[model samples]
Target chain A: MRRRLDMQLDELNELLTHMGELCQVAINKATKALKNGDVSQAKKVQKADMKIDQIEKDIESLCMKMLLEQQPVARDLRQVSAALKMITDMERIGDQTSDIAEIVISENITESMELVELTQMAEAAGKMVKDSVRAYVNQDLSLTRKVIEADDEVDRMFVENKKELVEYIAKDKGKHGERAMDLIMVAKYLERIGDHATNIAEWVEYSITGIRIEGN
Target chain B: MRRRLDMQLDELNELLTHMGELCQVAINKATKALKNGDVSQAKKVQKADMKIDQIEKDIESLCMKMLLEQQPVARDLRQVSAALKMITDMERIGDQTSDIAEIVISENITESMELVELTQMAEAAGKMVKDSVRAYVNQDLSLTRKVIEADDEVDRMFVENKKELVEYIAKDKGKHGERAMDLIMVAKYLERIGDHATNIAEWVEYSITGIRIEGN
Candidate 1:
């Protein structure tokens, strides 16, 4: 029975890794679509989000089953409960990526140098998502802390991006204000993605140390 | 053992209700701060969020203990799991309300007629939080649906508020543009509060019917 529970735990890790990869793809494609002004690419990101949502439900039921059947305790219980918490943040990352895609397609924003910083912000957030999940799969405590610290950079970028966008709107007045607003919204979504990644890392830390980190 | 489990469930319900009340206070104070441009009031919202966070941690531990010790199955399992999911959203509502208050205090937005619609939006979101928690506490299926449906109105208000803020910014060019941007951020936060409330309502529905409502 112990060996069976261990095997199921391994399976859970694999499933979570797969979900994390999907989130990376969603954020990557959404930001790429934003950079290239490729409507089809944005549409693809939206479609992929549905799959992420389905996977979340599958993982949730599996966790519930493990709790019921294996009756995990202590560290094992933390692992299962943390996975349950981590997936919600992962799912939100997917949803926010889809939201960015929707903005890209609806705004029909053409490629511009203006989006360079926003793209960089998206890349930073996506890397955090990847590293945070890897931290959990490997139980790398240092990597989790790295993911947490990286959130500050994404947040700083958001403030800078907003300032730049506001200036653009100020310069163009009514002419390009809506487009500037759209880009600001995109930046905000990326920042939120970063925040969710930080949340996942914090949960990973809790699983490992049995200590919950405040203010993610 | 069954009676003990029932008693524990009732305790969980009471804890959740208290947490929900804290969320309501957070939202109410944040919006009131926005309406009055009272920076101190906004600061109070930030401080109150810490209490909400502490309560969420307490509630989470209770849920985990109930799950492990009681080893509840079927309907009881669903109730415990649903509580777990509901608290995350509730915690987010608290965080978003704090975010709104941060903007209000930092932007130093003075009282203006411009805030009327945004205040209304905040009120609508707060009501949803109250009703969703009430629905969960009472297990009222109809109230759950009502909370779900009210999200549409909050959403519509967000769109209208955004349009109005954009117009305000466009007309003023750079002078009031930052303030306008801050108001828009406040509006976005309120919309997210509405979404989180909808999520709680969906979990309430799931606890009652075992049917998950998709796309809140």
Candidate 2:
């Protein structure tokens, strides 16, 4: 039974790690599509949304089944729950990708807006997602803490970009307002993705230490 | 065992309803405090953040326990998963309320100056939350759909308010640019609460009908 539990956890952990990779790929593809004004690619992201949704549901059902049959306790229980919760963030990240794609498809974010800062935010957030999952799989507390701290930088970028975007849109008043709002929301969405990644990191900390993070 | 499952579900659902009520109240308190410049009230909302977090942890543990023991199938599984999912949104709504309260406490939203529209958005969002929760507890799909549709209005208000606030703050430039950005974030946060309410309503629909309503 112990060996089987370990085997089961390894499989579930692999699936979760793969899901995180899929989310990262989706975020990158969608952001690239946004930067390049590729409506077709944007549509592809939207079309692919169902895959992420289905994967989350599949993972959820599998987790429940494991609990019923395996009766995992302590660290095992934490792992399953973390996977369960991680998928929610993964799905929302997928949705944000879709939102970014939708904005591109609408042809509104077409302004040759130098999005260097926004890209940085996306990179930080995506890295956080990746690191948090790896941290969970390896039970690396330091890596998880790193992800949490990176999220603060991502949020700071989001607020700074939003402030600049608001001023840029205000100068033009409605001409750039719509697209600008979309960009801001996209940044906001990514910041939220960071927030969720922090959540995953916190769960990792809790799973290891049995001490919940403060101010989650 | 069947009776026990039913009773556990009833308790879970009741707890869900109460959490939803707390969400509505918290959002209302935060937004009113935003408009009225009531820093003390905002501080009170900030303090409630921990309560929401505690409730979320409680609900999460309960759901896990239920899933572990009952091995619920079909409708039962849906209810448990929906409750788990709804609490994530509820926790986020709580966070947004706290975010709003903190922004208000900082006096930034007031410095941006066009407050009436945001107040209206808050009122509409607050109402949507009430209806969303009612639909969840009562299993009223009609009401659930109504809340979903109302999100469009809330979203529209978000756009209009952003535009107006931008224009208003543009007049002063340096006077209000930074604070205006925070105000926009606060407005976006309120809009997100409405989005979460719609998400809860969708989960309610799924809980009742076992049909996933992702889009349309």
Error of 1 at A168 (Å): 4.5
Candidate 2 stretches with Cα past 4 Å from truth are A46-49, A65-85, A102-112, A209-212, B1-19, B36-114, B133-149, B195-216
Q: How many residue pairs clash in each candidate?
A: 0, 0
Compared with the true structure, model 1 gives a TM-score of 0.72
Which sections of candidate 1 miss by over 4 Å? Answer: A1-23, A35-95, A98-114, A127-156, A167-177, A192-216, B36-40, B65-78, B105-114
The interface root mean square deviation of candidate 2 comes to 2.3
| lDDT to native, each model | 0.87, 0.82
Q: TM-score of each model's B chain? A: 0.95, 0.91
Give the CA lDDT, 0 to 100, for residue A50 in model 2. Answer: 69
Ten residues in a row with the worst lDDT in model 2 chain A?
Answer: A106-115
Please list the Cα RMSD from the true structure of every candidate, rounded to 1 decimal place. 5.5, 4.8
| Residue A91 C-alpha lDDT in model 1 | 91
